[model samples]
Target chain A: MSVLVVIECANGEVKKSSLEAATYGSKVAQQMGTTATAIAIGDISEENLKHLGAQGIKKVLFDNDARLKNFVNLAYVKVIAAAAQKEDSKVIILSNTNIGAAIGSRLAVRLEASLATNVVALPEISGSTFKVKRGVYSGKAFAEVNLTSDRKIIAVKKNTIEVGHEAGEASVENFSASLTDADFAAAPKEVIQQTGDILLPEADIVVSGGRGLKGPENWHLVEDLAKALGAATACSKPVADVDWRPHHEHVGQTGITVSPNLYIAIGISGAIQHLAGVNSSKVIVVINKDPEAPFFKAADYGIVGDAFEVVPKLIEAAKQLH
Target chain B: MKILVCISNVPDTTTKITFTPDNKQFNTAGVQFVINPYDEYALTRAIELKEAQGGTVTVLNVGEADTEANIRKALAIGADDAIRVNAKPTDAFFVATQIANIAKQENYDLILMGKESVDYNGFQVHGMVAEMLGIPSITPGVKLDVNGNTATVQREIEGGHEIIDAQLPIVVSAQQPMCEPRIPNMRGIMTARTKPLKVVEPTGSATKTEIDAFSLPPQKTGVKMISPENAGELITLLRNEAKVI
Candidate 1:
């Protein structure tokens, strides 16, 4: 059986998270001695879809419906289900994004497949039993989950796997689920895209600030450093709670959980709740004036300095790098 | 209008996660438990909606007898009544099945729950329940307003959010900025003691997934201290040594 990967794209390009999912699906297919087929969705071009061959995808299934540029849950699930049937895929993989989770859960039930979301590693298939490790307790712990059903749906966590690339192209073909008006009933009234150079979840470097940065007016320090480093800017819970930053920029237990390669936390006292979210970063650097700040314990690099003094120098240094 | 809020009992955010000696189960010996924070958003929003439209708010949990105290706490916070499905929460599949069974029979106008439990972080139940009952679901909903039989909800997407308007009898998972979660006052706490808490048997859907073991992440390496006077050096280290650039 072939493996089906749901690749989500936006702004006419495939998202980095979807690229990671494609790599994961190809690896799973490799393990099973089968080829991986991708069902391309969203507003990406077919030429870009062919580039999924770099992730080892053999063939690409394209849904030509323009309405798909906007996320329609029922319509997405129907297309994915149809693709899975056509490819005779026993395994389905997707990125654990908002759109992915929304459709993946419903697809699990509709396909009668056992689903494991936030899966960190590829599964170990031994005989008929499939085992995979997943993030639980909001990044506090990992649990080894065994999917008992033969049909398995795995939603790979973003940034967990290193994306694989090869200089090859996959053959693209048109595929349709033939939708009806009822499928678009819960369509979004409007889609607002957040305009930024870097998206936090997919960013390699993230510069975050806590209440330690003082007030909203002083946010330029964080933004300036992020600009120099070409990184996304984020905030701790209290900063977002007090309107110092937007809720979408908040990264913590109650907010977004980001696993960037390098997470530079400024003035943010590392609270347990905050750590629970960013603890998975490949490297953590904590900058706080208070030497006793709990975040220093989890940090790979610690600098006990006033942010107002240190950030400018850091930005200057980052500028010199380029 | 009838609203149902689903809450899960989870370890306090401050608790250090540790597994048993065999690494098979979470070590709950000294851990404190609290209502899943995300679920509290849904619980408070449902209470607020019920108070405005003059409807009943029912809090439901699919957990063992130990979860009853937390269920009562939800009732204290403002749920009109409570139901505890007596069974161990094996996985998201089993939990959603029980919730679907309850909602199917009761026919609640709105089914609300947290985006995901902090313990499992499954983020699966809302969609599964909505699919099981063949209803529209808006997940990780940041804003929700109800007028008559129509509900307007704002769901968080990647960067920005989307607004969706749906009819009554819909499922929505609560996220942050939805509504402020309320604490039970002495009067409400006292009243909750006499409120009806109905216990029901599990529907016994076979669990599709099982946790074989639990493990904490690897211990972080020791930090390399750098002086602020050498702030520029830190960036140099990040580029040349750390090679992150």
Candidate 2:
């Protein structure tokens, strides 16, 4: 049986999260004594698929139909189902991002496979049963899940596992599926991407602001720190709705959920909604003018001081480290 | 309008996660299960929709006999009926299969579910179920409106949100904005006891994936400080010593 990895691409390049999924799926295949086959979606090119070899992907199956370029639920699921069937895959893997969560789950239903999202580690396969550990309670804890079905699907949480790189030449092949126009009927009408260096979900290190910076104009301190760290910038929901930061960067219960390896919150009061989004981070550092900020309760480390005084120092520290 | 709300029985958000001695299964010894937080949104929203439209709300769960309490709680919250699939939710596929099997028989106009479970967090069941049934699926849907057989949904995208319109028999996975979960009033809890909870045996294969072991993340080191006035020293420490800048 084959281990199939679903890889999503944008701007003709594979997303970083998908690369990590590829690495993860390949590792799982290695442990299972199987080969890792990747199924690419969206506008990714063949050259980019070849580059995925560095992550130990042996082959990539690219669906190049123009109708498949956009994020359409029916079309994407059909494409993935077709690929999994063609490869006779026993396990399917992808990143636990918006697209992956949306598509991977539907694929599981069609394939009648066991699925686990937000999976943090490799599977524990003993005898015929497979088990995986996943983050739960917004990262407050972990749960070991057993997938007794023969077909399994896993959506790896972003930034949870390091991407493995090796030197190799992967075989990239063009895949043609017998999909009808009905599958493409629900294609997205538009593809809009937020323009910035700081993408919250894709960021390795995220620098978030709360009520601490005092005003929107004072956001430069937060921006500078994020720039120096090459990390994404975000804000709490209140900060976003109040116009201190754009709504796109809001991370909370009603906003975007992220699990970056390192999350730094400045001046945020750490409301439950806000913590719910980022609590899954591997390391949480809180910098608040008030030592008793509620968010500090969940922080792995804390600093009781002004973010204005602390952020620039952090930027300088990051630059020096680089 | 006939609405089917899917909820998963999982440990409370505050539960400490652990594995069994062999690490091949979840350590359920001290775990107190609760309705998945996300699914609560779905169940409540479905109830609210039914209240507004004078339709019926049905709560569906796939689990063993122990999870029937949660199904009853959902009924107490406002559902007209509850369906319990007699099986363990070993994986997303197996769970989705059970739901799809029930859906095939119900022919409901709208299917509602959580974005993901609090425990396994598969996040795939709703989409998978929708696909299996060949219906429109909008995941992480925050807001929903129903008019006759037409439904409009607001689904969260990466940076913003999208407004979508689809006909009846669609699948929508509810997140926070769907609705605030209603606490069961004393009267509702009492009425829930008599509501019909039909249990159905699952028609699916056994699970495939299993757990290997559980290991807690390394405990973090204590905080180190460079005096408040010497803020720059903290930078030096991060750069030279901590090396995590």
Candidate 3:
């Protein structure tokens, strides 16, 4: 039996989160003295599928049914089940993304595997018991969970694991699952692509702002810094609620939860709700005019200053890095 | 139309999280619990739909007696009846199994909940329930509209949103922009006390996962106060010291 990694591809390339999952799956496979095989979904090129070997995958199974390009819940689950059966996979790993969550849970039931989502660390396997650590309470606390079933499924949280880059090549094979018209019943009428290279969920570094940036007109401070660092741009709930930024960019309890390696928060008071979404960030840097801003207490680094002045300097400094 | 809205009771977003003395469970002594903020959106939207389509809205919870208050609060906001499955939530699989069993018997037209609970943050229940029933599930929904047996839902993707069309018998996990959650009015609150509240035994699906322990994230070291004038210096440290850049 091999470990199977579900690789999510967008725009004909593997997503950063999926690469992290591949890396994690490969590590888990190594610990089990087995190899990792990846099942590719969404849009991806054959050449790029082979490149997933960089993340330690030994082989790739892809469904080129053109119709499988967009996410169809049942169809995706069917494809994964076929792969799991073909590979005799006991452990399945995927990114804890929107697509992953939607499909992973269904696969757990269809496969009768013990399921764990939002997992942050590698599993600790001792004899028959396999346990994993996960973020819970919306990043407030952590829980060590033991999976009691023979088959297991894990949805790794984004940006929680470092991706391995051991250059290698993986063999690609085309596999087709039995599909019918029923599987396409819930397909989207249209797919809208976000207009940016960096996706917030996959971004390693995120530069975010809150209402302290003043208004929509002042969002340039956030955008410029993001551009300088090649990072994703995000905003707090207030900014998104007030229409200063798009809802997709909002990162908070009610929005998207992101755990980037380096999170830069500017002009945002650390609201507990806001922190709930980003508290898992590895290194948090807060820049606010108020020294006593609650976010400062949670920040690894703090700069007590005006966003107008501090952001431009940060941008200038970030540009010089390259 | 019959709509089922699921709600979870969780600590208020502002509650300072602390573990029990043994560090194995959440310390709930002084913490204030509220209807999960995201679930509020689902409850509000379900109520709005019921008003428009003349449907019965039912609120369901999987927890012990402590969660009944929030379930009743949901009734006061808009549901016609409430159900409390008598079991502490063990994991997403168990919770979803319980909900799916209840929904199967009742045959609700639409099932909705928040994208994820603020406490456990497990975004698995909706999909699992749908899978158990062999139905369609949409998550992190930003917009939803219904016309008889068809539903038009707008859900968040990585960059933008996708508008989907599904037949009746669908599960959707609501998020922001669905609608502003409504507070319970005095009249609704008064009427809620007399509404039918049903307590059911758990489906007894053994939890596949067990929590070994709980712990708070390590406290952040004191923030190094970097002067605004030398903001560039902080960047240097980030590069040379932190090596993040």
Candidate 4:
């Protein structure tokens, strides 16, 4: 059986997480003495599909059905299920994304294969046992899960793997999975757009404000810093609930959980609820006037000063970088 | 409009993390466990939907007998019935299998759970269960609506959010913005006592991914001090010594 990786694309480009999934799937394929096959979907261009070759993907199955353009769960799954059957994939890999985990789980049940999500490392294919280490307890710890079923699916966590671009002139091929009307239903009637410079999950850097900012009108200081640093903007749960910021920007236990590379919190006291959502960042910078703020406890670096003064200065300093 | 809500018992978010001598087990002494924070969103939303639409809600857990208290609490919060798949939640795969086995026998329209349990944070089970049943799963959705057999779910994407549609017999792993979590009140607490909690043995094989050794993260270093005024000095310290910029 071969390894199959599902690569998601948007506006003709592959997502960063999909690259990591391909690298992961290819390595798993190597362990099984086979090669990896990728199925490209969504609004991706053909040129981007070739990049999979650098990650050791030998073939790409492209199902460019217009019905599949959007993330219709049924349509996408039907097409992917078809590819997995055609490739005889004993292993399927995807990102630990809303789309990825959602599709991965449904696909697992459909195929009668065992599955694991939020996996942080490669599997230990010892004898008959195919096991993988998965993050549990919200990044607190891990557990090794064995897929007893012959077929298996895994969802890899983002930013956990280093994407490698092995030097290569890769080839791209197109294949089809004939989807019917039954495969596509309940298409989104409306798509709402929220304006922001960066999407929190996709951002390389994030600048967040909290109750410490004092009021909604003072948001400019935080926005200016985010703009100067080219970072996404976020707020603590309290700020979101109080309408200081939109609920979409809330990051905490009861809000969006993000794992960006760099997280900067300005004028926010770190509650455990907030920390659980963001403790996974590669680096954390907390700025609070209260020296004993709980946020400073978890921050890799911190600035204990007034946000009105600090944010402007920070923005000016960051502006000089480029 | 029936809903199935999945929850897990996890250590409180503020509990000091400690490990066993072998580092394989989390030291449970003096640690308080609560329903995973993520699952709270699912539970609250399920109850809310059932209250409005008029249907039963079932709470499922994959842990052993000790997890019954959480199951009961879910019932107190408005779930009609509870099921404890008597097993240790060794890993996501094991937990998913158990949920799938139990779900197959039920006629629920929607399956809901937290985006990721505060413990293990696998975030795989809901999707895996949906996959097992050949059903659609929408994860980390902040908003959900049910009309007849179709469900419209608003799931967060990287920067924006995506609105997706799926027929019933779907799974939704909930995050915040779905609804605010509600505290259980006196009347609901009184009614929770008689809720039927059925315990079932898991059907799938239980061998989890092999763990070589578990290790807690390195100890946190001393909290460094720099005067509030010399903020620029800290940057220098980071650039010169820490080299983290």
What TM-score would each prediction reach against the true structure? 0.99, 0.83, 0.98, 0.89
Off by over 4 Å in 4: A27-34, A54-56, A122-131, A144-151, A193-196, B204-213, B220-245
Off by over 4 Å in 1: none
Docking class of 1: high
- Which 10-residue span in candidate 3 chain B carries the lowest summed lDDT? B236-245
What TM-score does candidate 1 get on C-alpha atoms? 0.99
- TM-score of model number 4: 0.89
Give per-residue lDDT, candidate 1, residue B59: 92
lDDT of 2 by residue, B59-154 (tens): 999899999988888988999999998888866667877888889988999999888876655577788788889888888787888888777777
Query: Per-residue lDDT tens digits of candidate 4, residues B1-245?
Result: 77889999989887666778887777899988888877888999988888888998999998989888778888888899999988888766678878877788887899999988776666678777776676667777889888887888888765567787778888888887788887778888889888899998888756434455555443345445555566555545544565544
Interface C-alpha RMSD after superposing true interface residues, each candidate, one decimal: 0.9, 3.5, 1.3, 3.1
- What's the true lDDT of residue B38 in model 1? 94
lDDT values, one for every candidate: 0.91, 0.79, 0.90, 0.79
Q: Each model's DockQ?
A: 0.81, 0.31, 0.79, 0.43
Q: What is the Cα-based lDDT of residue A307 in candidate 1? A: 98
Model 1 lDDT tens row, A1-322: 8999999887899889999999999999999999999998778888999999999999999997889888888899999999999988999998988888898889988898899999988899888879999988889999999998879999999877889888899999999898988777677998778886688878999999999988999999999999999999999999999998988899988889988889999999999999999998888999999999999989989999999999999999999988
Question: In angstroms, how far off is A100's CA in candidate 1?
Answer: 1.4
Q: What is the TM-score of chain B in candidate 1?
A: 0.98
- lDDT (C-alpha) at residue B60 in model 2: 91
Worst 10 residues of 4 chain A by lDDT: A185-194
